[model samples]
Target: MRKLALSDEILLKVEKPARYIGNEVNSVMKDKEKVDIRFAMCFPDVYEIGMSHLGIQILYDMFNRREDVWCERVYSPWTDLDKIMREEKIPLFALESQDPIKEFDFLGITLQYEMCYTNILQILDLSQIPLFAKDRSEEDPIVIGGGPCAVNPEPIADFFDLFYVGEGETQYDALLEAYKENRRCGGSRKDFLQMAAKIEGIYVPQFYDAVYNEDGTLKSFVPNDPHAKEKIRRQVVVDMDKVSYPTKPVVPFIKVTQDRVVLEVMRGCIRGCRFCQAGMIYRPTREKNLETLKKYASEMLKSTGHEEISLSSLSSSDFSELKGIVTYLIDEFKGKGINISLPSLRIDAFSLDVMSKVQDIRKSSLTFAPEAGSQRMRNVINKGLTEEMILEGAGKAFEGGWNKVKLYFMLGLPTETEEDMKEIPRLADKVARRYYEIPKDKRNGKCQITFSTSFFIPKPFTPFQWAKMYTMDEYIHRAHVVNQEMKEQLNRKSLKYNWHEADVTVLEGVFARGDRRTSKVLLEAYRLGCLFDSWSEQFDNKKWMQAFENTGTDIAFYTMRERGKKELFPWDFIDAGVTKSFLYREWERAMRGEVTPNCREKCSACGAMCYEGGVCFEGKN
Candidate 1:
């Protein structure tokens, strides 16, 4: 019933005045009396960014499909906006109808990354909700989170009531309907979550008691409820074609990370790159047919009038009928001013055919992630792509008239030798030489070569599960070594060589594969003003270090130590469908400099098979 006053002098001066506007053309509106459940979908960032997210758009549209449930969008204010809200004493509120967030029955946050952890607490405090799960009562909004980061929700476990592990389409609505009926019968929050936890893919952290050894390793996690299952399966949509998704996406007033009509053509990836968390998490690729995709893309263009459309997936090039999809899109939208952007094209020069669609208009940098420098190191990570393939791809990218090329490699992969890293610059030099080889008459643009590299982090449930992470000092030292080697190898300084901050990258590794005790450090860091840790301006690594010190937990305890093959990991309880032996075997193969083929060629026997009830891919039947 309450609404934010637009005439308020303080509200006028804040950044992005559109963020506070409760009404948008495409947003759903519901009568207060009409809905049984009021759900607030929160993204731990400002509205400008949240409104641009495809996941939030999909979930918002999906939930609004239900007549009985009302879902609206909410986001954390940027520092400037937060200042005005705090000064004006404005509590964090939903965008539509300006309803105080506390009024919602459920607060669902998308934990996309670890950087959003502090922002989560900020939203809770401003909503007049208790920060800790144990401190909240039946009257408070039940806070929940879901995303890839939910795989290790322990760091922020005390803040959320439960975590939805995987795909949300089927289970979210199903859970909401049950909650509405139970609330009508006067059920408590505990009763609601306990009942919801019974649904597949729902993980209630409160209902489990976690026991850790003195060494900080997890002893066991015992379930409190009788119906609470040990294996919290990920929710999946078998027939994505039949699923109700948003054909009309919300068009942002400002440009974002992706300024295009976004389409998730597939659910999972077939390539089992050992270090990739997404490949492991979103297992068993399920795709929507070309007919459905064409329909959706056409509908989105008609509704939003967007200039570009991105066919997004782990590997868009790997789409079985990718050539057909792009050809059809270009044909149907001819002269409409809408172009296509492909995220993952094989770096092979053979890919120039796909690159020709919008190559002349879009002059962005080319990206190739060979992962490791040498073939042996590449095999150890099961990257599968050969050196010849990378060179061939780079040659094509340069020959295709792209001005800048980015070569992506990792510094501290398992079994990486100085000799292995020495090959990285050698490869970059070859790519650079290829760029200069173009004929003088054929060259239409200036040539530039950019090489970027990152530190490797060992992840849980992957082949690297038992591997030790590179120490911060070691990672930095090796990065310097790469730069030195590049100079000696190339004898030319035209190339731009860069690496990410080792401190932030190291912390990310600690959080990525950490367990329950890490929650203490996360909480302490948050309490000490550590939100938006992903942003360069807001992140204070020293503060995080202090938090770890305050908690008496060493970073090496999580990152640097190699676990025994038989040891129980904190996340070992949650099965992603892949068995433990499979991960261990992959680790063993990596140690022996062996490479495993992809799921498309051979089944690695990871547990994602449980999603489709057969092999993960739709046609695998």
Candidate 2:
């Protein structure tokens, strides 16, 4: 029997002791002496949130399948456990083996969002590992980071020895095999990193140097080591059907954020929304085989016994075989009291009909993400949604017994005017008006139209990457404009408006487009106690401000500055399938308020054709 990392006394004190305990259902176990590599896969957040991530689940299942590799999971302890561990001087440990993380061979952290930056330091600090990669010894785990944030690894490059620069299913086997070979040859730590750098999609930050011009724009990023390539092309999986899927995912004792079985129907998006980073990075959308998905749905549900199943994708409706798979799922499990969820679907007759079958009409609300309020602003962002479409969708839902409607929009978009801001509430009012158009005898109760707006932040691999951001005051003013306009509507009682905190959005913007120079500010902020910035209760904007002031880092430089046409970005060295020229051309189109067609409608020559698969070669021989 394995021993517990925390004592009974300590476990009794924490909120969710099950989070620290190992041996959950479906968690793999192996003898330490039998496995050649003990990998510690981490999601740098609390257990509940980390357990909900699909990427971690997929990678965990993939890693544990190898006989020589025993992968264990670790999540950042909550604040209560964090304080106790610090006071007791206990090192962070993995859940499966109940062993200290410092004893592992690799510490793979997924960078899912910008707000989780400080939590990465928290994980390192508690594990007694060196916070910076340069200070680590051979005994310490080779700290690596991946996921969507890996596209812009420069902001946190100093802290990670290496970064796996794309889809984990592609090159992880090569990386692990190289590590095994290096160990068998008795190579030094740096020698192993040099070997790892030779593999595609692997980035060794220490081997590369970034030079900045006097104006702080990136001058050049060249690699010093011969093994390190000049450009690290993102690894992509051309054949989605061939990759392993996590059918038997581990079941947590506590309720997680996504407490259901998730079936990823596709890998990429056909809709080319200009402000979307995922759509740009994951090009040439690929859908899973319908037969394969039907098989996995049964297997996952059988394994985890989850009542609800959600179809995961950038755009679930865009899946070519969505109707077929959904029909199969409903037919296969309808009588067994199973629930099906479909998100990211466009609001239309077919979608409404499908959702009506799966979801309870009276209890559920319909959601529409117009992204921008006005048609002109929608064109600028390439939302491809019009006010007429939104109202028509809402009208259908209202007639179909969905009285509650949720609308999402973005504030501070590039070239957003006062008319655009006011259009947000006006659009909501229009939806409410459509709801009241129904006769009182046939309609549900009073209609509730809720609309939320989040400030736009320019992300790394999007057409908006070169766009400028507004100050905190400017953002709040825009939200207030929308709020004030809501009161003037005829059905103001049915309309509700809310906006996100400007401070956090501003900080996220800085981190989203930040360079290596922002690392000092991050270090200082973590030292001053800034963990879980995404959580409302724990976020301290005052501490962040002090960190910036102490580090002499100006936030405006990252957020408010306009980029020249030829200015090089920090992520220029990464070739993420989508050409920079294509992105720039899209940016030009966005500035002209010209709408570019999605992948299915017409090929825009975005340079993802090099893969020669997926949507790019959908119909061709």
Candidate 3:
């Protein structure tokens, strides 16, 4: 049994003591003396939330499979425990070993969202590790970051020793081996960084310097080290079926956000939504083999004993074997009281039928992400959804007995106008009207429409990366416009309108497009006690604004200013399989309100074909 870092008195006082105790089923535990490398895989969030992430589970399983590596899980201490840890001077420890993270060989933090930036610093601070990579001693672990947010890592680059620019399954094995070799050779931290930089996906930020123009635009991003590659090409797993997945994922003692068996049906997206970063970064969509998926699903269900299972994908409806897979799960677990959850599915006749069979029509609400209000706005964003299709789908769903509808949209997309903003409420009214069109005898109950709109943040690697972001006031004004329009509707009593926080949206925009200089702002924000910025109640916009003021960093330079056609971006050094020329063409098409077909419909030659596999060549001769 591993001795815990927290005392019995402290454990008794915390809200969820099980979070710090590591005896959870499926959690890997090894003798540290027998391993060459001790990796602390950290998710800078609370235990329940972190354990729910599939990426960490995959990587944790992969790392532990190696004989030389012992991987352990670490999550940010909850606010209650954080206060006690700071006061007690107790170092942050891994759940498996109950050992300080400062003693680990590698401290890998997944940059899943922009809001988790401050929490990264909190993790380092609690571990007794230096916040800045440069300030760390040789005894400190090599802190690295990966995940979707790493596509634009310049904002937090100063904190990480290196960043893995793409999928974890691609080059992680080689990275670990290289680290072991370097350590055996008695290499210095700088020497190891140089060695790591030579790898395809590894980016050592210390070897690169950013030059800014007088106007605050990126003048140049040049590599200072000869060993560092000028362009860090993102690594991708071409074959989704070949990668290692955790069949025996850790089952937490406490309930989590997602407490079901999660089957990753596919990776990447075929639809090239201009505002979506995941669509761009994760190019050339790949699907897992149906048989392989079925096997994993069976094994995972048996191993974890989860009562429910969810299909995860960018677009679940786009999967070619979706029906087969869904049918398999439904038939296999029909009488077992197992529930099937399908998210991100397109609303159509086929999907509606499948959903009606799997779920209770009266209790379940159908969801549709039209993304934009009007057809023209939808075309601009390449959502490939039109008003006719939306209304038709809604009518079919209503006929199928789903009276409650949930509509999702983005407020400040590129080329958005006042008319487009108002169309959101109008579209919801149309859905409600369609629901009421059903005969009273056939209807489940009163038609209910829940409308949600989140402010758009321009992200790197997307067509909208060069687009301007709205101010907090502008976003709130837009939301207010929609709210006012919603109030005037005949179904106002049945309609519920909700908008995301404009303040948090603006901060996310700043970090999304921010350069290396933005690191100082992040550091200052962390110093001012900015942690868990993603949590609405914990986020303090005033402290973040003060951090910007203290750092002398102009927030507008990263968020409000639109980029020139030929201007260099801080993230341009990375080639995310998709070429810049293709992104520019897509941006031009978005400006012209021209919709591009999805990869399955036609090959747009977006340069993701460089991978020579996936949907890029799925239908090609």
Candidate 4:
């Protein structure tokens, strides 16, 4: 049995002791002496949130499949455990092996969101690892980062030794083999980083230098080492079906955010929404084979015995084999009393019919992400959703006995006006009016429309990357406008309005488009007791503002300043399968309220077709 790093006294004091204990169901265990490479896969968040992520699970299973590599999971210690570890002088350890992360060969952290930046520092501090990559010794772990945030890694570049720029399924095998070879040769840290830089998707920030202009904009970004690629092309799995997926995922002791069998139906998205970073970064949609999905689903369900299964994808409706997959799942698992959760599905007659068959109408709410209030604004964002489509979809859903509808929208999108803001309430009111139009006996209950809006933050690689974000006060004011509009509607009693906190959105914007200089602000903020900024209660906007003030950096410079058409971005060093020229063209089109068809309808030739697979090449042979 492995000895736990935490004492009984310490475990008893923490909120969730199960989080610190190892040997959870389905968790991989290996003999330390047998494995050559000891990897600590870290998610810089609390256990409940981290364990729910599917990416870490997939990578953990993949790494451990190698007999020579022993991979373990680690998450940020909660405040209670963090205080205890500091007072007791205990180094943070991984869950599986109960060994300090500093002793591991690689400390791979997934950068999922900008809000978790402070938490990343907390993890390093507790692990007794150097906060900055440059100060680390040869004995230290090779700290690497990956995920969506890595596309714009400049803000936190000083902290990571290297970043995997794209899909882990494509490049991790090569990276691990290279690490083993470097170790076999007794190579130093510098030697390994140099070797790693030569790989297609690996980005060694130390080998690149960013020169700034007098206007505080990036003048040029160039490679310092000859071995380093000038532009790191993001790695992509051309054939996703060939990649290994975790059929028997680790079942956590405590309930997690997504405590169910998650079937990843596909990767990438067909809808080219101008404001969405995910749509841009994961381009030219790729899907799994229907037969493969059915097998994985059955295997995963049998392995984990999860009572529910959810289809994971950007848009579940966009999957070419969605109906076939859904039908198969229902037929296979319906008798077992298993629930099927389909998130991110378009609200259509077919979807409504599917939902009616799988879920209890009164208990489940139908969700639609129109993204904008009005058709013109939707066109501006290239959302491909119109008022007629939304109302018609809601009408069909109401006719199918779904009384509760959730409408999602974004405030402060490019070209948004007061008229656009008011249209949100107007649109919801129309849906409510349509529900009333139904015969009294036909309706199950009164229509309840839950209207929610989040402040839009321009992200790197998106068409709106150069667009300006709204100030905190402006976002709040926009929310108030919508709130008042909803109150004045005839169906005011049926409408419920809610908006996200404006302060966090502003900070998210700063980090989303921030450069290397933003690292200083991050360090200072962490020093001033800023961690778990994503959690509303733990967030302190004043402390973040002070950090910016102390560093002499203007937050507005990143969030509120609109960039020129030809301005070089801090993240230009990477080629994320999408072309800059294509992004700029889309941006111009967005300004003109011009809508672009999805990949299945008409190819925009966004340069992702360079991969020559997925939806881009679906019918072209």
The Cα local distance difference test for each model comes to 0.79, 0.91, 0.91, 0.91
lDDT of 2 at 190: 97
Model 1 quality (TM-score): 0.95
Please provide TM-scores, in order, for all candidate models, with all chains considered together: 0.95, 0.98, 0.98, 0.98
Misplaced by over 4 Å in model 3 are 610-621
Candidate 4 residue-wise lDDT, 420-522, digit = tens: 9999999989989999999999998778999999999999999999899988999999999999999899998999999999999999999999999999999
Model 4 residue 162 lDDT? 96
The better candidate by TM-score, 1 or 4, is 4
Residue-wise C-alpha lDDT for candidate 1, range 257-319, written one tens digit per residue: 677888788877877788888887787787778888888988988888788888888977667
> Which wins on lDDT, candidate 1 or candidate 4?
4
Candidate 3 lDDT tens digits, 293-387: 99999999999989999999999998889999999999999679889999999999999989987897889999999988989999999999889
Better of 1 and 2 by lDDT: 2
Please give the lDDT score at residue 599 for candidate 2: 75
Model 3: lDDT equals 0.91
Off by over 4 Å in 2: 610-621
